[model samples]
Target: MITRRMLLGTMVAAPAAACAHSLTEPEYPRVGAVERLDPRLDAIIAPDAPIEVLATGYSWAEGPTWVDRGGYLLFSDPPNNVVHRWQPGVGAAPFLKPSGLAGPIPAAVREAGANGLDIDRQGRLVMADSGTRAIARVDLATKQKTLLATRYQGKRFNSPNDLVISRTGAIYFSDPPYGFSAFDESPLRELLFNGVYRLAPDGSVALLDDSHHRPNGIGLSPDERTLYLALSDEKRPQVLAYSLDAYGMPTGAPRLFLDMSEGLAAGRPGLPDGLKVDSAGHVFATGPGGVHICTPEGDLLGIVATGKAVANCALGGPNGRDLFLTSHDMLARVRLSRPA
Candidate 1:
């Protein structure tokens, strides 16, 4: 277990992108200094450790994924409908342009912005395609496009936001009615209540639960025994946790493991949209202020100190010890003793 003080011993605690931390203050920066959730966690992160801001740019940044092979980060610029690639040495550049939408002309552009990204076991670029209203993949090597999933029953999905790929090639994603609803835009009636779903290795799509109000971000614990889903549109939003079966399918009613509205006074409205887990069951959720570190029990253990309403984050760097964060018009980073 890592404690706050121990993390601070080796790290300097400061905001990398301090100016864009949030629209409002989160608890007015307490005078006694930030406290960690418990002493046991001090072994991992020190409370006063510095949070380094790596990059800052973009208009409403959404999904963030680590491209390990490229040794950098690839994330979304939603309103711009594009994806960017950022590396420490070269800085950020255009990674995927017009990432999704297609028009009459092959060069025609239509809102191709990407939402979330992940690499499959086979090394394919699996993406939560918001503009196309589907979960698609692009071969990281050949750059070939393959549609993984688009519809649940007979209706098309509203928009696929975030996804994770298991070792077995099984892909899981969260579909919420956020995008323009290109799939089924007829009367604007949502047939299925925004759900957390799974796409098996066989290419079959299964609805794990339609209960999630608006599943925004989705990730699995290192052990695969627990599944975490972020309800972005939740009133007084929260990150929910569920017990999963051996097959990696959820088996029970999802419950709130953590309520995100506690520390935030003025910040982003949604809970989280992108999340990543460490070797342990601990989860890092992008919240209104920054990347929130939570225990398996859902306790708010510490923060990465992005000083911004971090929209998404991923574990990367030389050994995955560096944390990359995202937000509206900002991209930041922090180093961690633990790997992403």
Candidate 2:
């Protein structure tokens, strides 16, 4: 069994070679394999498109999102507690410092930073601030930060990990123990179960599901009729799909979307974490070796293997066809045939 210290060390401890190298550039070649299982994948991903390493040297980079208004990509390096921005002509630079943990913190604490990020309908930056244990919004124009939700039923959340906003202004998020130094055993924990919740436009928080052992990534279908969640448990790594009603409440039992048991048993690098859906209803979930591309019905279509443990990805660019990935220590990108 992996102890808390061991898990934290595995995540934040940089390899000797990586620590010796410069953070401005990648240490390895920009190369990865694309496993094509269906012909339909050819229509989405170009056969010749290469995965390019944009930058490197981070202590667990995750939560990638694109700002269309600024034509830049923003992602978080949690262990470092900083957010970085990458653009076309200009390269990567720190956009925000103390990105997640605001005030004083213990020196031994780790993993205190922002995780998932998204742009709301108002163009404000919405973040799942694990350090703050709240879902907050940042106004780009004013640089002001405001807390959206902090507790459920008067109990403080363990940590808000990832979230997605609906067209109606409702927010769906997952509360997991990843932000805590000791994870589930952390004394800061309050809630009995890790839950997936919905913060409605009416300013009410509702529990959607608490069955997932370690809910991490979440996304909604293009039609907004289905909700997809990724459970980041090594023993039971999988993605589940739930049907939603007009009110956005889940209906009936969730269907098993994709399972990675075989891959995990084979010693693959990652578990189901963050995920996103395209206009075509294809799910691009970060799991196993890299990004797993599957149809809405859960049929595996292809895999984008970055040869590293990837955390999350976002679809953006001039036409929204550029796929930006936040791998373990590097930021990579790949061009898609069709726009996301």
Residues forming the 10-long window of minimal summed lDDT in candidate 2: 4-13
Which stretches of candidate 1 lie above 4 Å from their native place? 1-35, 104-112, 181-192, 234-236, 264-270
Q: Which ten residues in a row have the lowest lDDT in candidate 1?
A: 3-12
What local lDDT does model 1 show for residue 246? 88
Top lDDT: which candidate number?
2
Per-prediction TM-score to the true structure, in the order listed: 0.81, 0.91
Per-residue lDDT, model 2, residue 280, is 88
Q: Write one digit per residue (lDDT tens) for candidate 1, span 1-340.
A: 2211111110112242222222232221111122466765565566765555445567667677776555557788865777787666456777676777654312222235668888766556889887777889987545567887878887777667788887778888987765642323424434657777889988899989887666778888887778888776535467888888989877778878777776444543335567888877788886655567888788777765544456778876646677666755666665565664
After TM-score superposition, the amount by which residue 25's alpha carbon in candidate 1 deviates from its true location, in angstroms, is 31
Residue-wise lDDT of candidate 2 within 1-340, one digit each (tens)? 5531122120112342233233343343576877887888898896567898888889888899887666678899877888898866467898878778787875434567888999887777889988888888888656578888899999988888899999999999999887877777778888989999999987789999887778989999999999999988876788999899999999988889999777667666677888989988999998887898988889888888888777888998756788888888889988899888
Give Cα distance to truth, residue 237, candidate 2, Å. 0.7
